[model samples]
Target: MRSISVKIVIKTFLLVLVFGIFSKIYGQTDLAVKQKSNFWKQVQFGGGFGLNIGTGFTDVTLAPNAIYNLNQYLALGAGLQGSIVSQKDYYSSAIYGVNTIVLINPVEEVQLSIELEQVRVNNTFRNPTTGIVKDNFWNTGLFVGGGYRMENVTMGMRYNLLFNKDKNVYADAMMPFIRVYF
Candidate 1:
């Protein structure tokens, strides 16, 4: 699982790099002619939705955000996120988080983004040995990541760089995301 995740990340980064280079070469003239807009006109609304289902596992996530275009090249935004996950006779969990994001667009269609997030997770586990179920304590995580962006949407991956394996509710080293803008 880890190897596959790493491979995907590498491929994504490479694709972004190639796209950036090509855009720079062909889109330089387009950058000089910047379109002017008002503050409200520069604001955008969007978010992400995800669902995963398997034989005995299910997860759903929804994140909504608002973005302000600072200029032709920079943008800032904030958002809220909520998620739920469950596994048959195993565990069920709920996650909530707040995030702030910064995006840089070197060209019209290509973007780079950095995001910081604080998340709280609550979990309930079923102990097979004791045939009992108990609720675990709440835990918080701080995550950061950078990724490639596109017009009206972004496809990227993130990781909890500050997580402690023993205590952190999030175990995945890399998580992919798809966000849309309206």
Candidate 2:
């Protein structure tokens, strides 16, 4: 009688094992199909704008960007920038640029980033004696930095690897930045 009970128990376990193996025969909710449908959920959009007006001076800027998060540790993105600046009759300029960036997260609260940017600059300088002088040029910058992150916001400082004292737009190679994403 004991031997008969052991045989019945073995048969029941084997039946369950076979059913579990064949449960996905329909082949619809598999791993590859789920990942393909969820691709759009990984994209994030973010950017910033600036406006400053003072005595004989006006400056405005607009920048917009988007990023695709491949995973928790890596992200890639692109951005566009446009700025207009005028200071009385002394100077005026229009600046436009394109930028590409990569971000790496070493931990949940810290991130490392690198970006490459190229901008076209047009300057109109007016001197009472010299009249109007127009200067057009291109400036390229490679910035590498890190930041502290809190949810969708990050604040940090970045140093330009290609900074030129005579022709650069920024006053210093080291600059602070704030980034937000939604």
Candidate 3:
């Protein structure tokens, strides 16, 4: 039973890993561009992969989303993101979230943006001594971050705050992405 469960978990993780890689590759493709009445726009949609390293755990996230430019100085978009992490107690878990972004361009070569995200975490912890499943939880929180865009690449940093009192943990992470607009 334990072996089967482990196999299932590993398979799920692998699927998510493949999805993340493909999303990044597709985002870099030239299909992300959009055309308007009189203009050729850069990417109106984007996605990327991110790695989060903490004290005793590391997480990989596959985030995909779309952005609509409201104007030259403003944009709005949302994404669906999932994460797989290796935790301290030799247990692994997953989380899914929705993210929103705002962009501000001050110069032709530099673009600044802010992202806000809300996520739900489903975690399970097992006891090493007894092989018992002792901890399971559902959590939600908000994250805020900013990014800088240079040509086709964008880099950003953000932190997430776990809302539950029992899981009031915060995560600080960085993301860098490259996208090609058709």
Candidate 4:
């Protein structure tokens, strides 16, 4: 009975000591965070428009976005992106999902990023005179891209290989984007 009581007392002391140490650590962390909060509010809103000219086609696209800093090291934003795609035998419309951006700055005015977004495409392939509709379709693809920032603007490109095996037999696409970030 005495041994049991002594063991309980020792355990209680150790637990109290551990809690005290953790509390001190947490207090220091809180102080550091409060000191750095101002630097994070320097976020701004910006985006860009670019023309895509590729193999046998041309597209006009616009993407507008905003960024909010979560901390001194990370920022997040979303935007609208769309394009009018033209082909030799078809006309298609494409839209971008809420393009989510994660900004990680390694140096002043320079950032590396990982982005997740969806691309949507709708097209019509039919003879104008024959009145026979050959194809009408829509699709969505997931993609990842990265960018480099210079001053108040950024430039980047990404690739998306769609996997709509049923309607999109040969519907794989790759896009390069350039944007100005304020």
> Quick one: best TM-score, which candidate?
2
Candidate 1: which pairs clash? none
What RMSD does each model have against the real structure?
23.3, 9.0, 21.9, 9.8
Candidates in order have lDDT scores of 0.78, 0.91, 0.65, 0.67
Candidate 1 residues 1-182, lDDT tens each? 99999999999999999999999976765554443335668989998888999999999999999999889899899999999999999888888888888878888766667777777777878877976565555555444555566668667776666667786666675777676888
Q: lDDT-based ranking, best first?
A: 2, 1, 4, 3
Q: Please provide, for model 2 over 1-182, each residue's C-alpha lDDT reduced to its tens digit, 9 standing for 90 to 100.
A: 99888998888888877876676554545766778768768888998899999999999999998989999999999999999999997999999999999988999899899999999999999999999999999999999989999988999989999999899988999999999989
Candidate that scores best on lDDT: 2
TM-scores for the candidates: 0.66, 0.80, 0.55, 0.54
| Candidate 1 local Cα displacement, residue 53, angstroms | 2.5
TM-score-sorted candidate list, best first: 2, 1, 3, 4
Name the runs in model 2 displaced over 4 angstroms. 1-37
Model 3 lDDT-worst window of ten: 173-182
What root-mean-square deviation over C-alphas does model 1 reach?
23.3
Q: Residue 98 lDDT in model 4?
A: 55
After superposition, candidate 1 runs with Cα above 4 Å error: 1-37, 131-146
The residue-by-residue lDDT of candidate 4 on 26-110, one tens digit each, is 9999988987775555667777776879887887877788888776577788877776777766555554545777777767655
- lDDT comparing candidate 2 with the true structure: 0.91
Stretches of candidate 4 above 4 Å error?
A: 1-41, 51-58, 87-89, 94-96, 128-143, 157-175
Error of 1 at 97 (Å): 2.1
Question: Global lDDT for candidate 4?
Answer: 0.67
Candidate 2, pairs of clashing residues:
none
